[model samples]
Target: MTTHALVLKTFPAGSPRGSWPAEEFAARLREHGRGAEVVMDLVADSFLVVEAAPPPAPQDTSGHEASRLGAVA
Candidate 1:
């Protein structure tokens, strides 16, 4: 997990893309303190701001359950 893309501002052609929600675009970038879930406008009027990375530490499986409970060594 680790996504970052700042550019939440820039509209002109066909304007109508400012439904801020994701914590107000992460508070317009407050040193990236919060915000998770936002991916609107990209390229034309740039408007992407997402920062969610902190949930990937749970894969031990206890050594596959000790080899299916066949532990020995």
Candidate 2:
């Protein structure tokens, strides 16, 4: 499971078998540049359309590199 998944929409899981409206909706979101996906919620008896969390910012390593260089000198 992802650490953070925002539920954008919820669809009842009563669609005909082999038909996935939730997935189709998620695919449209993805096409529009959204990181969206569908996940089943058995307890809720529904499909959730979720957007994935953005990745964390890269750590700054300039200070660490400078310290290492100073130690070597």
- Residue 57 local lDDT, model 2: 54
Candidate 2 stretches with Cα past 4 Å from truth are 54-73
**Residue 11 miss distance in model 2 (angstroms):** 0.6
Please write out the lDDT profile of model 1 over residues 1-73, one tens digit for every residue. Answer: 4544444444333434655444464675655645444455646554445555555655555554444566535
Number of backbone clashes in candidate 2 = 0
- Against the unseen true structure, what C-alpha lDDT does each candidate score? 0.50, 0.85
| Candidate 2, 2-73: lDDT as tens digits | 377789999999999899999999999999999999999999999999987776756655555334345322
RMSD of 2: 6.2
lDDT value for model 2:
0.85
Worst 10 residues of 1 by lDDT: 7-16
Candidate number achieving the greatest lDDT relative to the actual structure = 2
Model 1, residue 58: distance off in Å is: 3.2
